[model samples]
Target: MFGMRKWNTPVLRPTAPFIIGGIAVFYLVAKAQDAMINSEEYKNDPRNPAIASGKKAH
Candidate 1:
């Protein structure tokens, strides 16, 4: 059958919706990582006193 022959191809095109969704997820994860790395709350935590004091010598 013609339909069966089409299915036998080794390469298949990705659908637009799935591609868009993957890009959105990747963007969101990158933004979250950036926010975490640059957050002031994370840098000034009392539990890590050394990090807070290290920035003051400059």
Candidate 2:
């Protein structure tokens, strides 16, 4: 067993650029969700209960 090879796995590292990109991605996703919740089709969708009270789902 000692002569056999072992699994080689890469370490997880979060660099500065990756972190900044992640933050930007999160911001864009949040903005996209906001736009979706404010869309007319979403507001009129039967599955959305908040629209019945004239309020967006947020």
Candidate 3:
């Protein structure tokens, strides 16, 4: 003898979009970081100058 409930359905089966969206976001972030590390733009950025001397501006 088995007892089954008629109202025992899952309420979260519509989360496929959110799960796929999260994976896509993570992939984009990783790709961007890889590009930055391998690109010339990161090496030529002036905000992070290699010179240790501070310049005085008028």
Q: Which candidate is the best by lDDT?
A: 2
lDDT of 3 by residue, 3-30 (tens): 8877776655688788889999999999
In model 2, what is the error at residue 14, expressed in angstroms? 7.3
Model 2 TM-score, all chains together: 0.55
Clashing pairs in 3: none
User: Can you give the lDDT of residue 29 in candidate 2?
Assistant: 100
Cα lDDT, model 2, residue 18: 81
Give Cα-based local distance difference scores for all models.
0.63, 0.74, 0.62
Worst 10 residues of 2 by lDDT: 8-17
Q: Mark the regions of model 3 whose C-alpha exceeds 4 Å error after superposition.
A: 1-5, 9-12, 43-58
Better of 2 and 3 by TM-score: 2
Clashes of each: 0, 0, 0
Question: For residues 1-58, could you state the per-residue lDDT of candidate 2 as single tens digits?
Answer: 6765688544445376788898999999999886886787886677665677668454
Residues 1-58 of candidate 1 have per-residue lDDT tens digits of 4445645654336476777889999999999875664577665555544455565321
Task: Candidate 2: list runs displaced more than 4 Å.
Answer: 1-14, 49-58
Q: After superposition, how far is residue 15 of candidate 3 from its true place, in Å?
A: 1.0
Residue pairs with colliding backbones in model 1 are none
Instruction: Give every collision pair in model 2.
Output: none
